[model samples]
Target: MSEVALLLQKQVSKGSWVNDKKVALIVSGVVLAMMVAFLIVPILSILSRSFAVSDGFGLENYINTLGTSRIWELGLNSVVMASLAASIAVSLAYAYAYALQRTDLPFKGILRIVIMVPLFAPSLVQAQGLIFLLGRNGVFNRFLGFDIDIYGFWGVTLANSLYTFPYAFLILSAALAVSDARLYESAVVMGAKPFRIFRTVTLPSTRYGIFAAIFVAFSLSITDFGNAVVIGGNFNVLATEIYNKVIGQGQFGLGAVVGVMLLMPAVISKLLEKQISKRQHAQVTDQSTPLQIRPNRLRNLVFGSYAWTIAAIFLSVPLIVFVASIVKLWPYNMAFSLKHYAFDVQNGTAPLWNSVGVAFATAFLGVVVVASAAIVSAKFKTVLSGPISFLSILPASIPGMVLGLGYVLAFNNPSNPFNMLYGTFPLIVLLYIYYNHAQGFLISSTSLKQISSTFDEASTMLGGSTLRTLFKVTLPLIWPTLLGVGVFFFMRAMVSLSAVIFLITPQTQVAAVSVLQLSDRGAANQAAAFSVCIMLIVIAMLLVVRLVLWLAGAKNVTLIR
Candidate 1:
């Protein structure tokens, strides 16, 4: 061959090599585009409407909304309430995680499992349980001859702490699990005091996790509307206020203004969490060994007590709801009955079925979408990968109520292309997946990142197409994570409130929303029944998943260990 021709041939071969990965690029583009259409554009539209005025886009709406003293009061209320809740939750979660991870606490497995009970149930269920326990005419209150109020700030704060405790515990436990035992051993050899060692070594090591938990807890607490709406009577937080403005009064402009304000703190917290997560990954290296605590009598006793107390509190909500679900009536009858389960009042169990349908659709669709996007973004790192990854985790920071409001404004418009999805079933499914996509993406991407890149290179060299390799190699390797993602989606979708609350129509009512409505109308027992049904569905689904995994010879996969 001529020299020029040889050079051209080499360049063409290199171009062909680059072109071979166009499948990844195309998948990345499609995922990113879907994210923009569903997540990004709706958020932008809501933000833009915050500045909309009669003539054109301006600050008049913001001025009108923020100039009111009520707005400032609501903002202050949210900050104070969320800060208090986050502090309590993080403190409890840290101690619980520490006991489970660092100490040889008794019943550690049971404690760990019980601590996650709050995660499966809706926050409203917790609030209602609290009401049944401590509200006016409550069983404990009346039995003890005391009148305690479970309303306003304290109620909301406590319920929020309960609702967000598991999130913090997960982060903190993961942090504690991967610590370097050598540090503690060296401290022991140097004769460092226990408190000193904990302060200097343990605290410093898990600081990123501590901060991440704090931010995640605070963000979740402030943005939550279910607990606030149920327990925060006459105590308005920013989230409930936004719901009132947007849904109650049809003041989209005002709601958008508050949502825009809520967005600022949430976005900052999310960035901080992202940074902390990145820092947390470096805490353990190949040389790190698992820390095993030698039990000290007094220390073990104290830690075990702490763990038990926290677990009891975490389990109380669901337990109380379970009892309430079977009761004929509260404080009056006190007789057990299954009439509430009949759900004869509101469409007679149809809502629960609809919820199941929504949850199933969300699980299937969520796993597919999040897994594909995660694999592409994690493995390929294409030009659009960064934005795609950001979009995946963006929902963690955005409040469900705000996202729902955005959907209402964006898709409900006559001029919008998605108007057909305004009150449809598919829109709810999309919202469910989008709202809970972050956890799925994080789990899947983390799993994918652990598998070495050599596998992909080898697969390509062996002439396997990218899709073929993904289905045959990558999918099987990360199948456990995918299963976890499905369960996560289904559980969240079934228990979810804020995201699909506004989107649910009379014809498409969901169980969780029905619980809210039932509680609102003073049918606390029926609400509890619905909550129990939701929990039962989640537990059944989990069991089925585990059974399937075992039957398939994948006995090691756990939904959440």
Candidate 2:
């Protein structure tokens, strides 16, 4: 009887394992189908369009695009500007992150928040603010009696650097936050100097992070359209060339060719990033002691000054933007006025409301999509796991403008089942979700990775199914992270410019696009005012989410992820 009972128990365990695997396969299949439909099909459609010729599909478009000396000039400009911006942003962000994570600086929270200002507003806001401060008739030229010109290459480079700074800071901060105290102690015992220890021990540990930050900043700078359009003037890059080709000249083939070219650098950088990350060893082990920040007066003072200076530069952009928005006239008059806030541009304030609605929708649906992808990829061990994981993070390598162009190419055709969604708000929301999917997926996966798999095993042993364990155990533990992901999607949908630019119809114009239009038609103050509204909405959203987290007894949880 004892042997029979033991055999029966073994059979029951095997049954549970089979049930769990089946469920994982189903979930993985569903997620993979969605990614292929929404992500893969669109990208392929655009690539096909690039090869389409008058007679049939051919390489005529690529040959023509590459043969142009103008195209080569734009490509060189993009590579050079992107390289400079990425270097500047990464170098500054490294110092800023080091100050926050390793030093005993006061008001580190405020300094950190200050650097994130660029993330709150549209990317063009940096260029707009620079114009207000240093344009031909800007504050410096008009009031400070200095000749200044904020346009063309240097202007766009500076704007891109400021725009990409926060992203780098986030990656570097995470890298510096973890260190094994034992390594530092051993170095000190060997009588290594501080700089030598930093060069040998600190730098090597965070090398992966530095590479990651460089990749992010480089990708952002190279693909950015907002800053280049606003401040580039005659200095065009590949991003603007794509816009001019498709939107201005109505040449989808040429635009598609540019889009394909844009993918090359991003793909190469992503491949290199993967190789570098594979070489990084685990920094924190079971027996590792966390490195503690020791207070040093000179160290604090030096880093404090450096951090605040960077913070002040970051703060000044939005500050001047607010000042410009309310002033009667930017450089001619200093009197206060609310005329710009009236939003006299096309569609008045409808775009702002439209963006709010879209942001809410994106937040709700994005949480479901990204959370599902994360749960399936992280929790399941299925044959589909490798493909699902690869596709989920693949969007990070594709530029926003390229993805937006792909959406146009893929869904605009009448034969496509998703054609009805082409010009609608739902389509725009989907674009925003997938355009920013990789980041949200990463955040969710990181959170899910922290929760032990022992809970799943225990639940299975007690006769719980995979779905039951997910809801009864996993969701309860990671719901806060899901909330953070929701907030992230909300913020992104609110402020994003490039991806949605191609998707918006006249009726579905979002606030970010409105800012672009206003700036384009030379309504600089109105653009500034529109930007202020977007920033306020983002801040309000953050506060509301924080309040909800506080009420839920998860007060320590950050909404930014």
Candidate 3:
């Protein structure tokens, strides 16, 4: 009887192990299927459409697109503008990040917050503010009597530089945040000058980070549509070309060809970034001492002035935008009025409310989808983990305009099973979620990785099922991160313009599209008004999330992961 009882206990333990594996397999499979269905299939559809000629599948579209001098011109414009913007953004951001991290600068917290202003508003705000400040009849030309023309290549380049600055700052800040103090001490003992030490030790230490920032800023500049659309008068890039071909001329094949062209540089840059980042070693280890910032008045004064200048440039955009939104007419009438807030555009404030709904849905659904993917990839040991992980990050390489175009080609057909979802708000929500999936997945994955696996081992030893372990052990520890991811999704959905541009319809107009329409129709103040509303909504959402975190006793948790 004793032998039989012991055998039964062993068999029960084996059964629990099998159950856990099965659960993991199912979750992993589900996540993989969703990614392939949403991400891989839509991109394949774009490729298919690009090859679909009148004579059958062929390269005629590519041949025709490449045959034109016009296409080459546009391509060159895109490359030059992207290169300039990336170079400018990366240089300024590297210095800004260095000032904040390396020196004891005054107003560090306020400057940090100010620099993130671009992230809070739509990308077009920079272009709009530039127009208000530097255009033909702008503040400078009208009030200050300066002749400035901000309407072509230089205009687009400057706007994109500002748009990409915060992104570069984020990357470089993290890179500079950690370093071995011993290296600095040794350099000082060798009697090296500050400039020499910076060139030798500091620059080399952050080489990978600099490369990564360039890659990101370049990709963002090349793929951005909002800034170029608003201020790039006749200085067309590939992003605007895709819009004109697909939306303006109704030429899907031509648009798909342009999409393919745009995708190449992003993929190449991502590959290059991966190769370069492999050389980056851990800067802080168990034996390493943290770098301490020593106070120097001269250093503080110089960096403080530089950092605050950049911050002021960032703040100027929204500040002018808010003023423009409320003024009766920009640069013409000084009287303040709420006339632009009337929103007499096509859909009016309905699109703003629609955006709110979409943001809420995206926030909820994105948290579930991204968090599940992260957990499955990080915690599970199934065969599906590799594919799931690969697909989760694949969206980052695909440009938003390309993805939006792919959605049109994929779902707007009669034979397609998901044809019914075309031009629907649900589809728009899904686009927002997947379009920003990579960032959310990385955030959740990073949080999960910091959590020890011993919890899983201990839970399994007690015969708790995998799902049980996830709900009881994993979710509790990472719920705050998941909340942050939700807030991120909400913020993105509010301000995103490119991916949803091709997806919005008459009945499904969103706030970002509304801004585009108003700006395109020459209703600059109305567009500013609409942008202000969107920013307010985002700020309110952030405050609410922060309040929730504070009430839940999770103090000092950053909401913008």
Candidate 4:
């Protein structure tokens, strides 16, 4: 045998390089294709249907859409709400990040977890709370002796901003958490004031993350149809415009146009995000240890108080929602009822079973993709790994509305040869997975990267195949990470709205959308009930995941901080 052949075959076992490489390549490609099919196919379905013309190919829908008063108004609303909510959300995130990174506060870890409440809980919770507090004759209104309306622009903006803080915080905090401590030390040595050091060192260092957070928060806000439909009250936005077109008018062409419209901003934002992020990456040196900032007494107290206050607000809102769900009329009777849980089955359109099944399936599939891609991309880190990593994260920047709108055009086309998935449960599952990959991939990849490749290399040298090494050596070491990914996938899929609103058919409805629809039709109590249910399921999953991790010897797996 040739030296290379023998070395490869000796895998210390029965395998040639070609054989192992071929297996890996084929499997990887198949995984990638399935992933693409799940995500891209549905998106294309929406786009194709939008562009389909009577004379073959024309911009009739786009032109008609641009001219519509409703669409124009909705588009304007979407922009303003996204801008305002993102500003508020990002500000809180920046404050929380600054406090945690630069302040020396007591129970800092506890403060972090409180801020994370929104990340774990769905926005629906906040949506319901806003209603209970300000929705004509709500507790706060009656108790304080004033009628408050939780609808239109202000209502949606408030809920979206309050709910999205955890995400911005996570992004900004991670960006600011680890920096060169030496720089701060030098600044102090040079007699630089605290504010000067922050402006020159801290802000510049984490500018990439801050920008990314802003873009991400903005994308989430404008794209979110849930909070809008629940609280928007005829407030026109690109997202709700798509909803009106598809569901209200049954016009897919107009719907796709709105989808395309929504895609434009996301694409621009994503491009800018990439450019900034790339420059930021180039600035990073290969230093293993990042310097942690030491906190001063006053600084610690101020930051801790800020983070704690925001977290307290997040924690309180959900509790408020839960309480309101049980109230019969909220300040009307001052009495409670259990009848809201009866599941009215609304217009005979509420497909609770379908939504639950799809959410679960989406969660399950999300786990598979996260685990597989994380192992392949993070473990290998080869020429192809960078592309895989990018593929996983590229969707992160694409808003759910765009993905849904794309699906309407892509998969719903009858002319398309592979159009079988249209109006099917499979479409919902596919979209759920697509929107969720970046999240799970983030968790799984972070966990995977912490493990050294030496373990795998040594396992392979001792005759274990790559697959075997992954199962035996790699997985055991990172089981906690995998567990975390699975829990998040389940929760996110359950709570998702962007795609469900677009892909939902009578036969394939979802809880997230159902809650929105119920709220739309003025079934606040029922919507509140359903939203609360979803939160409980998510919280339950988190609990089970933590318990399982504890049983498996996973340590300090707390997500609170």
Worst 10 residues of 2 by lDDT: 1-10
> Against the true structure, what is each candidate's TM-score?
0.94, 0.95, 0.97, 0.88
Which regions in candidate 1 have their CA more than 4 angstroms from the true location?
1-19, 276-281
lDDT digits (tens) for residues 1-561 of candidate 1: 244443543454655435547978888888988898899988988988898888999999888988899999999999999999999999999998998888887777788888888767777887988888888867679778887888999999999999999989998998888778889999999999999999999999989889989999999989888898888888989988888887799899989999888888888988877876775557678888877678788888898888888888778778878888887888788898999888888688999999999999999999999998898888766888888887888888888888888888899889888889888899999999998888889888888988876777666555555577688899989987798889989999999898888788899899989999998889898999999988889889888998888888888765863
For every candidate, C-alpha RMSD to the true structure in Å: 3.5, 2.7, 2.8, 3.5
- How many clashing pairs in candidate 1? 0
Which model scores highest in TM-score? 3
Quote the positional error of residue 355 for candidate 4 in Å: 4.7
Tell me the deviation in Å of residue 285 in model 4. Answer: 6.3
lDDT of 3 by residue, 13-108 (tens): 767657778889898888988787688889999999999999899999999999999999999999999999999999999999999999998778
Q: Candidate 3 at residue 276, lDDT? A: 92
Residue by residue across 179-283, what tens digits does model 4's lDDT show? 766677799999999889988987888888889988888888888777776677767678777777778898878777787788888878888888888786533
Score residue 7 of candidate 1 by CA lDDT.
50
- lDDT value, candidate 2, whole model: 0.90
Q: Which is better, 1 or 2, measured by lDDT? A: 2
Q: Any runs in candidate 2 off by more than 4 Å, and if so which?
A: 1-24
lDDT of candidate 3 at residue 187, scale 0 to 100: 100
